[model samples]
Target: MVPSPALDTAARAVPRVRPAPAPESAPPPRRGRRAAVVLAPAGLTLALGLWGIRRQNSMWRDESTTYQVAHRSVADLWHLLGEADVAHGLYYLLMHGVFTLWDGGLLALRLPSTLAMAAAAAGVALLGHRLAGPRAGLAAGVVFALAPAVQRYAQEGRSYALVCAAVVWCTHLLLSAVTHPRKRTWAGYAAAASATCLLHEFAVLAVLAHGVALLSARLPEPLRWAWARAASAVAVVLAPLAIVSQQQASLVGWIDDPGRPELLGFAIPALVGLGCAMAPSAAAGPVPLRALALPLLILPGATLLAVSFIHPIYVDRYVLYSYAGFALLAGAGLEAALRAVPYPKAGAAALAAVAVAALLPYSIQLRTPQSRLDDPMAAARAVRELTRPGDGVLFMPARRREPILSSPGEFRGLRELALARHAVPSGTLHGIELPAPRIRARMLTVQRIAVVMDPPGRPLDDTPQERMKREVLDRSFRRCAEREVRGMVVVLYARPGAC
Candidate 1:
């Protein structure tokens, strides 16, 4: 049949159909670009983190302790672990392995911690991404990587940095598993949590914090059940270690409770510290309090107070996990605050200014060894200079018996300096040698006896040795020479015949 005009128009207008858009292609994620943007700041933070790796006070007493314990033979370390520090034996063992390749100087001893700080920075980034968004994660990582406290420990020869790194990673994995419970995520959580415990006993508190954060999310029963299983597995694995090191329980005895005022002081600054931590370089002004409010300001401070009331053990540094919390909160706050300002760029500039300003003092302090710690190397040098062949150096008061008598804790550097200088007979004086009569008699034969004192006071007089030295030895020998160096008094005594 002949087609009508309307039918003809309809046939001509008809078109072939095509497939619909394929799920919008997810807008290309922009993940790479976002990561690049975040990484720029993170890289700066990492640079700053490693900036003063060697510019610390000569290894302090605590650092010396780490070096001494870690450098022992494996068998020796095992034998001494229970007596010395069972709690940190694993850390010493790990560091011991690292020391085999390099001598245990400040740099070599602290290198692992520096690397651990870098890993922590990476964990911060991953955590920020997982907790908030990619931007938050980036900022958090940058903040953590550049934090003064983190940098401080990162450059020190201790286990705190490694513990910090493990905790950060464990938190990251923990939050991930909480958000999406699966076999793989649970496995990661277990591994990270296990490592955290191995790194430091205090890390258990951080696991508790993770539990709190997770419980806040209100996950379903299945996920919760799975998480419980994973956590239980970790506890099972770590219980034996904890039992073996039960002696560590005594270390907490010396801990004093922090009062409200002390808590407030620490809490307030910890928040500010977060801002300085996130910013690449700080400004020349104060850090904003807003940035420190969440994890930094309230959570850590409050948690510590709560822990103190319940467990009665609260030391500031022991809550190093609080540092990570501060970094995260600061990053989130800075990002949020910057977004709210009229000019994001200007806000960023202002924030950057404040961050740099705040960081300057800490940076300078970190770079100058004497600024952060006593000059142990100088003390060692002083000891070396005072020693002569066949001359015996005695630490006064007997109880002060150590390499320098004034500072025994810097044993690592002290011993190294002693070995390098070939100064033999560097033993500490016995308590018995301090008797006035004994000291005077010994000086008669030991003509070159040198006396070193701390805080500069006259010799003790209670002992018979002191009376004899004052009555008899004082006339026999003149006070030949004395000088003060690095907060110590060095007095040289020469016999009358020798003089």
Candidate 2:
């Protein structure tokens, strides 16, 4: 109270203190909101996948193989893998477990694919969010769910969808590892990559993309070394499978060189993805996300396509995981466009409308019987309607037996003229074929024969047995009727007077 005048003057000169600015690194809002954004796309994918999961009343040729293989006992499956379809052995084993739990019907068979697709959708969203933002993630996930190709595989009973899911999550894990550079994160990445390759050996191509991403990131030396170690481990683990599958590569001998239209189909989407990744977007953070997305989207398909010129091993389904990268790029592009528009919400709505409009017709067509190469059930029914109890059924080329194999009940009374052993007994996707002499002899004994064949103009099977079948049918029988199913021809041949 009695302080000197000098002290009072000093107190008056003191500057006022300001409150501390909010911490720039305050913990992010509870992750629940972000999780919701990612989960929403997953939910959409699940709904779309499940909508017509069981609608395709019949299994196609490939699904028929799955059905035949999955229905076999574990011992038989193991034995079959040693002889054929080693590439698909793991998937067949998985389906065996699924069927064991619930032998409900096609629903049980296809549900796993549907669920895997949904998981892939969610992974795409999360990966997009990590690279770009929430909006981009959401858009990417929606785009993925609506993709006709993705939807097609999602409803099928096969391993392609699972491979896609594995690749998506593996990409996400790669992003995590690069950012954190932790042992646990890299381990997760390895596990994901391994699972992807195990689902389908072709998926090992994804690792090339991962390597590119790691190199482009320019991480610390320790992190880079860690990635190399992790990648090497994955390769070592996958080598055995790759070698075995290579021996059975003949299983894919049917895949032809892709034509101009097919190349265009693949190029268009990949170009779109690249364009999106290159586009300037503040929402898409500055780690050259394009470097990551581009390689994943383009490398696998391009490598396969190029190699196919030499080996004819290219098929779209084998590299379906590339779609995830495309979806991520598309989502980012759509979000960037929406942000640029005067009315962001309206722009987003319009974008979604355009996507739906573009996809609806194809989606509708996909649900019909004609969407697939052939409806096995339809072929079986057609054969049943045309044949008598004692008629002999012959699958020309032998592999054409898929339809009948899928609907064994329909042809119960008819003799399989050239079958030396049934698929399960023979431990083969189709079945063992009789010798040429045996086939001809069997054909001679039957008064009426029903032939299951490939469509006209398709290359005919020229095996000796097939040639003999043709010769005997032409010389001893008259063509009574012929019908064309979606992807096959059903011909009725009878003794000249009997017709």
Candidate 3:
């Protein structure tokens, strides 16, 4: 049908309607200032941590293991992959690449770990800021930097620091994404979480913690969906590593039980460490229960205690991530207590004073004898100086023995290998790996010397602690010279020319 002339004219002359402009939320002008404030704590913490690491002792046993494993030939390392510690394959490969560029000395070996710990402190600060505010971040960062446990691990060459860093950053990103439901934040959370898992398997605990945090906060459905999606992505990426990690699960069953007293002592010391780290001594000592929230302390303390009883899977290093939570709780508790007093600033000032007082003493303590980890290089030097051509070396237990004696880090199958390469013909013996009869017979025939890392003592029974101690030492030799070098105890010995 043909349109009417009037209708056609009306349509042609159509009304002019303007589309509405999209609404724009004003950008926060003080955002930059707030960001600086939020990050200030983390930055200062990182700086202090770096400084402490510079002044810290050299690499110890675990660090040594990292270097040796990393330095091994790819073929040899591949063979090792089928053995124990397939869980650490990626970390070993990464460290191996790192050691190739630099001599695996103390500084070179530990640089990566130092950086990792710094990153972890920053992540803790970010988490605090997101959970509370910039002030909370500041408190958390400073406390984290000064944290004796963090300093101890950061200064060493190990995977814990790296794993801790990943946990913190991933936690922060996950929380932010869940709180805001942004694709960028979700993406970041997924990536960080995956990296954390690669660095250490225990990092999966952060995911569990994140879930708890989200549920506690009652996050929105859309945000939860985003978080779940990010989590799924991380799980997918980590599947292969998970499969490989299964190969090392057998080690879990071997974890020695810390007796009741030992467990309690460990728990108390850990809590005290946190108190000393976060609160000023004045505050922690005079008014710890009040200054730090009782509920905050009680909840976690109970959880850890329960974990010890239920699963019995407790280690100082594994629960290291809990430090972040403790720091946050400490800051909040301090803030809450301060708010209760007549003058908020006075309470804060008093708490700050206490924090400084508490930390200074422990920081001094850390610089002293308590921080000593190991000494392999000096021991090696001593052995080398004493040994003549064709002299033989023997370790009573094999698992803790390595050729390179300078550092106390993990031997990574390198102790015997290195000694053989550098000091061969003058071979070494590890009783644990080699049959005791063969080792004894070999020692009887050769110009044999024994060096035990521990003090002079008889071998213990085949209990876990005794085994661990025995394996770590070289026995069946007498000390010729004992000296302390770089916080390590070195002993020299020599066997009869022909036994």
Candidate 4:
């Protein structure tokens, strides 16, 4: 990388008229450029993550899961992972350590994601700078930081952002190994790749993307085989996790088969990435941006989507690392677009400013609790305000119990009609529920019941016990009052005219 920088610095250091070489040598200027491109977007990402760090003190269903799981005893967490969410076990363990150091509620839960996203931004800058010039690198970092999906996940308390960060940095290592070709570098690549896949099993798809880049670049036989050995080692490391996660595949059973909207989602981005990659400047190097970026941008999503037809496993976040590839191409394309004009640097700055201005509305929207699918914290507040003494509680699909899982104090006054065991005890996210017959009998015992459910138009649970919950509540209890939370519903039901 040092010698590569000299190539760019040689052109810039062509005996400038007024500049002093002592203060402005190649290394110093290069160091300044590196910090400028890397830190600028990283700072912006941190700012975005911090701006609405709390989401008005709201925690969504997923974050609520993270809160409860991370707070669990290590033994319980380990046990729970085997039964479900084995793929995310590594992340849960990481967050457990995070909360151990500083259990600052939402801040503690989410700060790691914020930091991970910032790291991801820095990695994107470095990768772009290595392939193209510093301007392209700066552009790529900014593009990644400003992506709506990146912003959404940056504040999320989940493995996706960490996976994104790990994948980006690991891809950078892969590139480094292409040039440096040392045994130690390959070892680092394997360690990084394994860590990324461990964050989420689906992240192994990134290996396929890396393989494509290696094939397309037409590197020497030794380098190619080294990547294969490294990739093979990563696969070996992840094999156990893959097997475990497959057994837990029901965790993602909620995903629908890919439809027109889903097709369009990948198609639009694929076309744009292809266009940007075709630009002559974007594809100029030993490992050109297009050679890597096109495959990285397309392969993961395409593979996942193609596999989704057989197993229904496609989701945008599952392939979130693909966004890094898109950002790289876009940044290079932006620089190429401006290359024909005079004062290209000025043009790039103006374009970046315009982009910030254009995306202002979306940036503001990303901070709100409403931006998420559901806010369990808001739903908890609804449950707290509506419950009466001796009232029974029910979660329509059982998983709707997410609101009170982290804040069990709210469960104190209300008796849970269907619960047979608590989450930690049962090794489940939502507590296990009684059979349909028992649930029916229990619902009849309470004078009033409070039910937590999904928003209207969301799919209902088709399980028999869930059906019985709805049937008994509707037939035996009359709706007294109801309120809508950001992403869920809370309804109070009374026996006969008790309301």
What would the TM-score be for candidate 3 when compared with the true structure? 0.71
Give the candidate number with the greatest lDDT. Answer: 4
- Tens-digit lDDT track of model 1 for 365-473: 8766564434444544555565455443444333223335324433322211011111112211122344454555555665655555453554463555445544553
Residue 433 lDDT (model 4): 90
CA lDDT scores, all candidates in order = 0.61, 0.85, 0.58, 0.89
Q: Lowest-lDDT window of 10 residues in candidate 1?
A: 415-424
Q: What global local distance difference test value does model 2 have?
A: 0.85
TM-score of every model versus the real structure: 0.72, 0.92, 0.71, 0.92
How would the candidate models be sorted by lDDT, starting from the highest?
4, 2, 1, 3
Global lDDT for candidate 3? 0.58
| Model 2 segments more than 4 A misplaced | 1-30, 283-287
Across residues 286-399, which tens digit of lDDT does each residue of candidate 2 receive?
Answer: 245676778888989999899988988878888999998898888888888888889999888887888889888888888777889887777888899889899999988888
**Candidate 4 on 1-499: residue-level lDDT in tens?**
3567868889887976895557444467778888999999899999999998888888888899999999999999998998999989999999999988899999999999999999999999888988998988998998999988899899999999999999999998898888888999999999999989999887888888898888998878888899989989999999999998889888888899999988988998889888988776744457988888888889999998999899898999988889999999998888888897898888877987898898889888888887888887777778888887799988887888888897778767888999999899989988799989999999899999989998888888899899999899778889988989888899999999798
Please tell me which predicted candidate would have the highest TM-score against the true structure.
Answer: 4
Residue 338 lDDT (model 4): 88
